[model samples]
Target chain A: MTGAAARTRALALALAVLTLLPFASHSQFFVNLAMLTAISAALGQAWNIAGGFGGLTSFGHAAFFGLGAYADAILQTRYGLNPWLGLPAAAAFGGGAGWLIGTATFRAGLRGSYFALVTLAFAQAFGVLANSLDITGGGSGILVALHPGAGRFQFTDRRAGYALAVALLALATLAAWRLSVGRFGAHLLAVRENEDAARALGVPAVRVKSAALALSGALTALGGVLYVQSYLYIDPGIAFSAERSVEMLLVAMIGGAGTVLGPLLGALVVHAIADTTRSLITTPGVAPMLYGVVLLLIIGLLPGGVVRIAAVRGDG
Target chain B: MAEAAPLLEVRGLARRFGGLRAVRGLDLDVQAGTIVALIGPNGAGKTTSFAMIAGFVRPDAGSVRFAGRDITGWVPERIAHAGIVRTFQITQPFAGLSVAENIRIGAFLRTRAPAAAMEQARALGSELGLAALLDRPAAALTVAGRKRLELARALAAGPRLLLLDEVMAGLTPTEVNDTVALVRGVRDRGVTILLTEHVMQAVMALADRIHVLAEGALIATGPPRQIAADPRVVEAYLGAGAAARLADG
Candidate 1:
């Protein structure tokens, strides 16, 4: 079989194994780490669609993540909507946010570092809005009710969070797989490589990038839904925090930017390092500082990410 | 009716960058199935004229008609979608992608299926003498290989009109001869061609007719023999002595 087909089968097998994780007798801390890893993978995959494949590098994915969290929490608390409905609702809010930001930046011909900075600024702005907004409960944040059942998307068994996280990772991984094999994905990559050449080839550069960001935003937002459901609470500081954006980027960058499983591998590595550092050092800000050093090291030593070492054939 | 309008028509097309008139009042027509050449000295605005026709640069004050459709001010993607595509003077292949993937991107202009696009890309690559190198990254290719890859990519789009910009800028004589034949084969496929080249031999060998420009204005337009004999065209290149030297050597 071709590399892509082999990779697909491997992905299916990995997901199958992850699906059974909840049934194992793992400690709660291990389960939490597993859940966090999967969440990071999903978020990384979502970002990779735009930044890795489409070359719409963003530093503000926390905007969509926070939007989804608030959307799900507010819908359940104020509007009496099911947590299940929040999936689509949160995705819409994320997609709309993408559309709003993409239209403004792309139309003005922003690209490269400028585009990255704009995303960072947008994330910070959203964080401020969430901090002050009353509907989001201001600085205090909001909480989901303690309703435990599959119907409510909440579970009494805490291990269920890992299972749900795996499901999200599968969805995002499938998205990356589809992107690698699709014509639109080819066009998006071409645009990423050279916009003028892509335009000359009949690829609508701006529209393709905008669409990529919207799809990525929607997918990233799904992780937000899972977050509130798992923790039963979310504050702007946690939801729209700049660190959340950094972790998403860190995961994708460390794994492999454009490959199908890059983010998954990256998430596992990043989370493992994070948890190890947290345990080793009780001092505040030390773990994040290490992350910064690691990011710089990765950028300097292995620009292609950790997955490149494992790739037997070209990722494309 | 009157010979169905030319595949491309440019009338009074002009562009200026500050005080420098990059291209001005440029008028040209390319008939269907014909390979037309636009030759000029350095700074004669040949590349700028191609950009205007291909919609990379909007003309300062003029119109562009392609197959009878006035396409003035249209974006590059829109113009390409309308069946007109241009190759870059400085080859802009996706450097990290394989030659097949680069051509496949052009093939995607017509089809949405990855299999179909790859099939087309494969066929086009072989036809352009790039079959052996299809699996190699574009960056690894030599100048001649990149030039051929550019041609194959543009052809894969199934363009009705192709604007070839300096496809043979730097090449040995044998490579130039091969490219000339390839371009002729392309015209046989019924795609109209408009090319800008400094390579006089290729221009003389391939162009059905030649248009000579000097300082953003057409100095002469005729068959290759007639264009060679024009004193103004010779003057534009330099003195008669240098012109003869360039034409022969």
Candidate 2:
């Protein structure tokens, strides 16, 4: 077997082992942590599509995530719709929001820091709107009643939720892999590297970027749907928080932004640190402070992220 | 007398930046299956004219017709899809990708399958004498290597009309000879080429027709021998007492 194939096999084995881990552990806290890690990994992967590959670093992914969470929460609470149906609806909402953002910004030729700031403003606006709206249960947030059935998108045991989260992560990772190996991914990377050159070579720069943003938004919305289903409650603060946006970008960057498994590895390290700090400290900001220090060290020492370090060691 | 319609036609193409007119009412034509050279001194708007023809720059007036269809003001990708592709004056390969991958992105314009694109990239690499460097990152290439990669990438797009901007600006004498042959080979393959060049030897050796631009407008257009003897061309580009120097060089 070639080195890449062997590496892929090893990764598959590791993921398989992780998916079966909840069965061996009786601790609900461990399962919950594992689920959170998987969800964050998926979210990071979604962001990587546009931010890493297409070179559109968005600081407002929370808009899509919040839209997804609200789509599910509102439909479930008011319309009594199944969460399975809500998934596609949430994805559509996210994609539509992405279309709007991409069209408005790209048409106006807003790029780089301007594009990032505009996206941030959009997320902030969505948060404020969600907070003021009565349909979103005002600032206090909306609660998802515990139906406790697979049909209701709720599981009686933590194992099912863990399984679902792992599955979603697997799906997201597969999608990222497919994109990285295909024509669309090449176009996106070309646009990222040099938009004018790409367009001169017949790759439609605006269309490629807009498509990437739409796909990313839809996938991120799926992550949001998973989050609300697992937690059974969500407020505008939790759903559309700037911290959530930062966390997603940080996880992807820490892992290696454009790589297939970078986000997953990043999520493991980040969530593990958060879980360990929570267990050891009563302080409110200690975990985030540590995260900042680690990020600084990573950026200073290994700008390519932890994946590059692993690749170098593997070569040795 | 009415002549055959040129593959690319530009008329009254103008552009301005504030008070400075970059390219003013430039009219140029390139017939099918020929290597045409656009020659000028520095700041003669050769690059700007190339950009306008390739749809990179919007013209203030006039139209560009490709295969007799108006393509003025079209987006670069749309114009490229209509079979007009361009290379940058400064090479712009995707530095992070391998040389083969950089070419493969261009090949993707013709094929959707990754395998097919890779095959096309390899063929182009071999054709351009860059097969050995295919797996190396583009950033690792020399200046001449980057220039070759740019040409290879443009070729990989399967262009009917190629607008080359300063492709042979920096190269050794031997490399220039090799590029002269390569340009001939490309023209032999039925791809019409419109190139801006400063290398007199390559232009004299390769160009079937030469067009001279002076101050954003065409000053002379003819066969190489006529262009070389044209006093107007000499005064505009070759300078005083430099015509014999150009001939000697």
Candidate 3:
């Protein structure tokens, strides 16, 4: 097997083992951490498809993430629908939001830093809207009662939640792998490298780009749905925050943008750093500031990101 | 008497950017299995004409026909779907992708299954002398290699007609010879070709007929030897000695 195939097989085995670990060990805190890592990694992977492959870096994916969370929250809380069914509806809303943003901005010709700014503005706008809306629980948020059995998708034990998140993470990774090797991935990368050349070669620049944005948005939404369910809570500040969106982007960028396992590695590093920082720092805000400094250093030293660094060292 | 339809045709093609006519009232016909070269001075709208024909630039007034089907103002994808493919002046390769993968993308337009596309890409890659670079990142290739990769990719698309924009640009003389041979090889596969190049020797050596463009219009059209003798083409377009070189070739 090639390196990529070998890595994939290893990942599959790891996930298979992980599914049984929760049942074996049944540790709540470990379960929580595992679930959190998986969810974050999935979202980061989603962002990588467009930002990394399509080279349309977006700081606004939180809009889709928050919308997905809120859509599920509203449907289940207000309309009394099941969370399992509501997930797809939430993802669709996320896709629509992606389409709307991509169409308006790309047609008017937004690119590079300017494009990033536009996405940031949209994310900010979505956050503001979420905060002001009453039905969405506004800033105060919605709390759901935990039902800890098999089908409720909620668990007091936390291990089942970890297993669910692991499954989701595996799915997201598989998707990223397929795309990186597939025709759409090649076309998107071509667009990223040179728009004019790609267009001249009969690659549908607009439709392919829009489709990438939508796919990224929907995948991120899946992570967001799992996030809301695991915590059994939803709030505009938590879900739609600019910081959260940046966190997702930062993870993907830090790991490696175009590589399949970059997001997962990034999530692992971020979680490890967070844990270490919490132990060292007494102040609440100091940890995030330290993370920011470290990110800046990483960008300065390895702009292609850590995955590239590892690839160069032949570690990956 | 029955006459064969042109493999590709452009009629009344005009593109105006506000006040300037980049391409105005341009018409072209490409016969099946023939190599037609469009030669011009810089800023003479040679690339612009190719862009309009390939559907990258929507003409203000014009229709493009490929394989006898109207493809006027269609998007690049739709035009490509109609069996007309174009290569760029500056070779654009998917930088992070491998050579085989890059060609696979072009082949995907013709096939539904990924496996079939890969098979076509592999065969095309070997034909284009890119079998050795099949697993290497496209960015790692030299300029001449990149140009060849682009050509190979376009050919992998199974184009009935190909519009090659300066594929010979910046190539070494030896590379140019190799590229000319490749172009002849592609033509042998029954793909009609329309190309733009400043390289007189290569074009004269390869093109069955040559069209000279000066300031957005066709100034002259004839065999390579005849175009060399045209005074208007010599002074207005191909400089003094360029005509002599064409004559020698």
User: lDDT of all the models against the reference?
Assistant: 0.88, 0.88, 0.82
TM-score of 3: 0.91
Question: What's the lDDT for candidate 3?
Answer: 0.82
Clashing pairs in 1: none
For candidate 3, write residues A1-316 as lDDT tens digits: 2665655556546545654665666677777777787778888888988888888889888988888888888888888888886679878988888877887888787888898999899888878888888888878887766776656666677776777777777776787888876778777887887776666556778888888888888888877788778888988888878878888888899888877878877787787787778789989899879977887887788887776654554323
**Residue range B1-249, candidate 3, lDDT tens digits:** 016888878888888887777877888888899999999899788988988888878888988888778988788888887888899897888887788887887888777577888899989998889889888889899999899888988888888898899999999999999999999999998898999999999999988888888878788888899997787798766476776677689
Q: In candidate 1, what are the lDDT values of residues B175-223, reduced to their tens digit? A: 9999999999989988889999999989999998899888899888999
Q: Rank the candidates by lDDT, best first.
A: 1, 2, 3
Q: What DockQ do you compute for every candidate structure?
A: 0.82, 0.86, 0.52
Instruction: Supply candidate 3's per-residue lDDT for A26.
Output: 60
| Model 1, CA-based lDDT | 0.88
Residue B111 local lDDT, model 3: 74
Question: Where does the lowest 10-residue lDDT sum fall in candidate 2 chain B?
Answer: B238-247
lDDT accuracy of residue B75 in candidate 3: 80
What candidate 1 gets wrong by more than 4 Å, as runs, is A1-19, A281-299, A312-316, B1-3, B239-249
Error of 3 at A225 (Å): 2.2
